[model samples]
Target: MSAIVLLVLGLAAMAAGYLVYSKFIAEKIYRLDPDFKTPAHEYEDGIDFVPTNRFILWGHHFTSVAGAAPIVGPAIAVIWGWLPAFLWVVLGTIFFAGVHDSGAIWASVRNKAKSVGSLTGDVVGKRARSIFMIVIFLVLLMVNAVFAVVIAGLMMKFSSAVVPVWGAILVALVIGQLIYRRILSLPVVSVLGVIALYALIWVGPSVPIQMPTEVMPGLSGNAAWILLLFGYAAIASLLPVWMLLQPRDYINGLQLFIGLIVLYGAVVLLNPTLVAPAFNTDVPPGTPSLLPLLFVTIACGAISGFHGLVSSGTTSKQLNRETDARFVGYFGAVGEGMLALAAILAATAGFASVADWQAMYTAFGSGGVTAFVQGGAYIIHNGLGMPEATAATLLTVMAALFAGTTMDTGLRLQRYIFQEWGEIYNLPWMKKGAPATLLAVGSCLLLAFGAGGADGSGGMIIWPLFGTTNQLLAGLTLLVITVMLVRLRRPMWYTLAPLCFLLVMTIGALLLQLRTFYEQGNIFLLLMDIVVLIAAILVAMECAAALKRSRAEVAAEPE
Candidate 1:
């Protein structure tokens, strides 16, 4: 009903849960002892493992979790009405996401910073480790592929004018780094960089970039754009982290934070009337029921399997103290919940009329590119003080930049996982880092090219497949965390609540996808859904096996 009421409640819940409940979990249950030597300390390295301040680690954790998923998921879920979406985000964060992330960090700390995969093996069973790794690689592939489409769609719609906004942001980052971290005592350059960023926001529309035309031939604008995105990801992964991914994330995170604040302030100031229905009484013909669909639709904002990747991959290794993991991991989930709230507000508040909203929805319903650009434009113009056309273009550019960050990070993570997979499997070509890197790059290129040509329409097929795959990964992540908690001998109530909730929601959603595919008879979608369903079943089985092993281990030990 009232947007403000929902906002207040959601924000308050996030704060209290993070501050009070999370702290209790960390100190009483997990008992995160700072003196306990982490795997980072045991295997100290300047590159991946080094003790760092909690504040900076929070920044890293926040940036990793806050990505295109939050924006896209809420933007779509709000179609059902903001109430369901809002409730899911708030409650999910408190009961599911916060617990999952915090528990992951605690488990890693207790187990010498070994990854969730390794912990799963030790606690659950050796077989779970293999299952976890395979699941992770598949998840990363889908994540990289989907985000590639999202960014490319934005580029195609806004390439004519918004390129320079992204360029300006990147340039500002470079200058900031040079002045603050490199040149020392150069406040003037950093100040100038900030000014330039704003100036680009003002004058961004004048900058020219190539726009897709009919003459391009074969591929639609969306398809061609996505291909280029995967290409960029492949190259970005091969380079050093500092050169692209981290710097870009820093800039994007700041921009995203500012944009969200502006949008929320405007919404409160205007107090726009909600035009969309409180609930869509009549479900769309092919849509699933709200029960499971809502859970699948709002993966990133509520709970994501990908967070575990970030938690164990780099964040765990950089933790300054075991206790700090609670703040960085749990609070970071709350931060993402806030972003999802922003998206819900934007979607529900800014529409001028129900008719206008419906028209836009119908036009864009089948096209991910259309929905994203139009939604971005609506938020900028109606929720922020900006000209409609200019705001739309700016929003498109921002989307592209945000997608760029996701792609770069996804690609790098994928490469690392592939190399690990190779080593574990004893692949001859992947014994050395250089050859493995090349193989990873080549795999990315091939995937990109194949995605581009997969459908006669270029890359449209990738969008839905990406969504399914991403959600499946989230399910896998939930399974791993559930098993880890059980192995660590956490309270049964604490471990089983989130575990059962996610399992039911995810499996229900997967079955729904399978039904949709069977009815539509779309071979590609049908195949993808079948595969995801099988993967979900395997993940469940793996968790069960882990639980049995943990029980046996506990029983065999002398009491």
Candidate 2:
């Protein structure tokens, strides 16, 4: 297939999902209320609970959830074939992610804007809440570890990206102050922000920041990069939303769109050919089976549990209207699906022929990003006449910035989980910000540096598990939403089917991973996988019981 055909089909499918499917969900299932006073308005704090415009909130929510997963996951999953990845991304985004995200927003908005973690207690059972929180904590740890390694690897590979990526952060700090404190209009600030980031992009290639081994004695490359990245995450997570998190996300969001536009425009002009096979069961030695593995591998591009965290944990708190959840939640999911599609196209069409494509798949580690980045650069060079070096630098900056956004958001979410765990367990000290932040950051540090594979590639070792755990969390979140719908006496089949499907698939994936990890004798990952499987099963049972009771109640109601 020509790249244009694939691109057009993917774009058309997403647009249709947003227009028809999402509308049905908004009106029939979620029944988003226009008049409902959102938590942002009710709380009205300028810190975390400030009321945000729909567009700005969408940007924040989209960038937080998009990250490297959508790009990296699809790039890797295409190892099986583009057909499986493509089908999963399109279908999963509509049926699974859109529903999960929208339900999270509705659940939180109705329950004082608590996160999925807290809602597990209120909507399901208290014990289920604890289990759910633990699942979240583990998932965020994996997110932090994987994304830290991702950014570090990108920086080392494309040294030119460091300046633009960091420069964007500094620009965001200024933009945040202008918009949040001075009450500048979003359009005005956004236009200026985009312009500033583009300038940084232009200047980045000339001023690369290389971290040599001698810079930190024993630490170099990924190690030094990991430490510095986490330090930034720790600080960023603790700051108020308006200061760095929100504005930085907003800028990254724009950069994401710009990158997409450039990529798609290149596709139109050059019309690259898709060299990857449409369907291939013959993966390399040690590759997992296609069934459950494919589902988990492409989680974020299609359906991710992490989206529930961003929806309920942060976005719900800032939503100006309940109705906007449809736009921010559902559309946010569709946007991610598009990003995944672009990754698929880049990876599949990156090579000049079938042999070259197969060669690329052999090194799927950091090569995942390289596949997309190099392919993207090829398109830009061929179509737009931009220098290959500049195109690569620009794309790398966007990818690193996306990862950076997700890392800090993950840390912030982890902090919230830690604080909740502390309060629920009667540890007053944990409820305080400092201890909780420290605990969250410290756990990430231990996992990223200590257990991380050589040079902290530990994140790579557990990525398969991370994907499965993420879907498991999504299943748990849907279970919580199903119970919430029951309490509201509303139709829940929309949520129930996806819940069952995800839980079963994730469990299967987990089992498959357990055998692999056991054989490899990776004790830490094996133990982590075991704990996640047990917790997920327990949560599923509670949700099943609650769902059964809800059905029973419905059957017994007066006719």
Candidate 3:
């Protein structure tokens, strides 16, 4: 089969979901009210809460939720074969992710813009809140830590990407000022930002950056970059959303879309034949069963609990209107679906032949970001006539920028989780922004250096738990939305059904990983997995009680 055929089919599916399914969700299910006041307007602080343009908010939500997972997950999952990964991304985005993401925003917006964990207290009972917050924190911890490592490794390997990735930050700062200060129209500013970012990509090859000799003892190059990244995230999280996060995500969103277009267009131009099987029946010695693993492996592009965090944690606070939830939330999932599709195509079809692709996938985890970058660069080199160095730099910067945006947002969300705990326990100091941010960054640092020693790759230790924990959190988040729907006497099959399916798959994956972790004598992951499993069961118990009560109340009232 030709790559163009898959490309056309995937893009068409995303478009149809956005146009048809999302409309039914926004109007008939979510019943979004355009005139409903949003927390962005209600809170209206110069800091975290500020009304934002829909395009800009969508960009923020899209890139922050996207991270490197959509790319990394699909790239890795395709080892099982492209067919399962492809089907999940297409269908999951339409049915599961779109509803869950947009519904999260609507639920939070209705409840005065509380984060999902905090709002769990309001709807699912206070006990559930504490349990839910723990899961959210773990997810963020894995996200911030592992992404820091991923970006640092990419920078070390693709030194040319280093300059453009950092340069894009400077460009975002300028774009932020231009848009907020009204110094330029959005279209003009957008055009300038994209051009400047691409120009930086052009300049990156000439100005490749290498880390200076160890800043301190025991700090390897990767560790130094990890520290620097966390430092940047700490500062970025403390800044106002309009100033850094929004503009950075917005421009990154545009740049990524262009990168997607280039990759998709390359597929069309080259019409590369699919190199991997649609469904591989060949035996890999230790490959896990495909049943639940594929779902967890492709968690982000399909459906993620972390996207619920982005939606409720930050996106809800910036939404200018309730109706924007559909775009900012649902279409945000679609954007990631697009990215996931590009990843599948790059990993499977960008290779020259079946044998070449086979060499790359010698093991379950062999073909990852490396495969993505190499294969994608091949297509761009062959199809678009771009210099090989430039093509590599472009994709590398794209991955780094998305990961950076996610890190920035994850740190901020982690800060909020701290503050939420503060409120729950009545700790005045923890509720403050500065202290909360310090705690967030400090904890992530402890996990990095403390666990991984000099390399700061400790996040990978817990990353195996990320997919299962994240999916369970998504299931929990959906439960919250479903309970709200039951309270309002609204149709809730859309949310409830996905909730059941995810919980079953995620908990099963958790149980499977537990056995593996135990057999390998990995005590840390074993303990962490057990903790997550317990938390999910406890929260589900609380939510079930709440759901029963909600249904009883609804039934007692007349329609």
Candidate 4:
């Protein structure tokens, strides 16, 4: 099969999803009302609740959620064959992610921009909020820790990426100050910012910043980079929305757009043959089965619980109008699916032949990451006639930027969770945002530096669990949204069906991983997996009880 055929097919499917299915959802289900006032206006605080342009907010939302997961997951899962990964990315985006993301934003907007964590009380009853918050906090801990390590690893392995990543941050700070405080127009800032970004990309290889023990005096290599990155995250998390997070993500969104255009254009011009098989009945030794693992492995590109967090936690608070939720939320999911499509295409067709592809994906450790980077190099080299090494370095820098955006956002959300918990537990000091911020950053540090793999790869120790936790969270988010819909007297089979399927598949994957951990005598992972399972079961039980009560109330009402 030709790569162009697959690319066209995947893009067409996504267009249909957006035009037909998402439109049906918007008109029939959500029924977004333009007359409805959004929380951005009701609150109207310049700090976090300021009304934002829908296009800008979409950039912020898409870039933050896209991260490395969409790229990494599909790259890894293509080992099973491109067919399974393709189907999941296409159908899953429409049915699962679209429903969850848009519904989450809608629920949050109607509830005055409360996060999904806090809104659980209204939908599932007040008792469920505490448990839901705890689950959310733990899930975020994993996100922060893993992302920090991932960023550090990239810096250590690809020194050239360090300059562009940090350079982008510097650019964001200057742009944020000039535009937000000095009243510069977005068009001027955007053009200037993009120009500066390409300059950084060009300068990265020439003057790469290398991490050393001398920088921090005791920490070296990955450890040194990890500490510095977390420190940056701490500062970034404390700044107001306009200062860092929003501007940096906007820049990242541009970078992603450029990368996508280059890759897709290459596919059209080069028309590479699919080097990877469409179906792999000949399973490799020690590889995971295609059943539940593939679903969990490709969680983000398909659907992620984390998307609901961004939708409800931050984006919902800044929406200018209620009707824009479909554009921001549903379209954001489709955008991510496009990124995943790029990943699948790169992994399947970027190589010259089957043997070359197999060599890059022989095992499931770091091979997938290498393949994605190298495959991307191949595509760029062919498409634009750039040197492969330079293209690979450019892609690495882009990937690191994606991880940085996700990390700070996760940290900020974690701070919010901590503050919420402080109030629930009657701790007055934790109510102050500073203390919660410190605590959140501190926990991420401990996990990233202390409990990680022996070479300062703490994220690796917990990496295997990330997929299961992510999918489980997605399932939980969908379930809560279903309950919210029932309360609104809306039809919910669309939400309910996906929720049921994800729960069953995710639970099976968790158990399979649990057994793997036990067999390997990895007690720490075993315990973590057990705790996640318990949390899932408890949350599911609460949803069931709430639904039962809802049914009884409907039955008793005069019809």
Report the lDDT tens digits of candidate 1 across residue range 1-559: 5556667788899999998989887787677887987766777765456665565466557667767777778777766766798889998888778877877777677667766765666666666567677667666666666666556555555654455535653664575456335564444543554465556766766665654554266666666656556656666566544444444554555556666676566566556665557786644455567887888778777988777777776678777788888888899898889878876765665567777656544421332334444554565666566777876665555556655665666666666676666656888566555665566545554555575563123234534544445555555555555565555566646655666666677678777777777787877878866776776677778767666766677668766
TM per candidate: 0.87, 0.96, 0.98, 0.96
Looking at model 2, the pairs that clash are 452-458, 453-458
Q: Rank candidates, TM-score, best first.
A: 3, 4, 2, 1
Alpha-carbon deviation at 205 in model 3, angstroms: 0.6
Q: What tens digits encode model 2's per-residue C-alpha lDDT throughout 34-125?
A: 99998999997777787887888888899999998898889988888888999999999888898889889888998899999898887777
CA lDDT of each prediction against the hidden true structure: 0.65, 0.86, 0.91, 0.84
Off by over 4 Å in 1: 38-46, 50-53, 109-115, 160-169, 172-196, 212-228, 363-384, 431-434, 454-472, 482-484
Q: Candidate 4: which stretches are off by over 4 Å?
A: 213-218, 453-455
Ranking by lDDT: 3, 2, 4, 1
lDDT of 2: 0.86
> By the lDDT metric, which is better: model 2 or model 4?
2
Query: How many clashing pairs per prediction, in order?
Result: 0, 2, 0, 1
* Better candidate number, 2 or 3, judged by TM-score: 3
lDDT per residue for candidate 4 within 1-559, as digits (tens), equals: 9999989989999989988998888888888888899999999877778788787788788888888889899999988889999999999998889888988898899999988988887778776776677668777888788877778888888888888998899999888887777578888888898899989988888888777635555556777777778788888888888888888988888888888888899889888998888887665677877889998899787999999888998899889888888889999999899999998998888999899888887775434556778898898899889899888987887778888898888888888888877777889999887899999988887777688643456767877988888877787778788886776677979898998888778788888989989989999999999988887777678768887887677668776
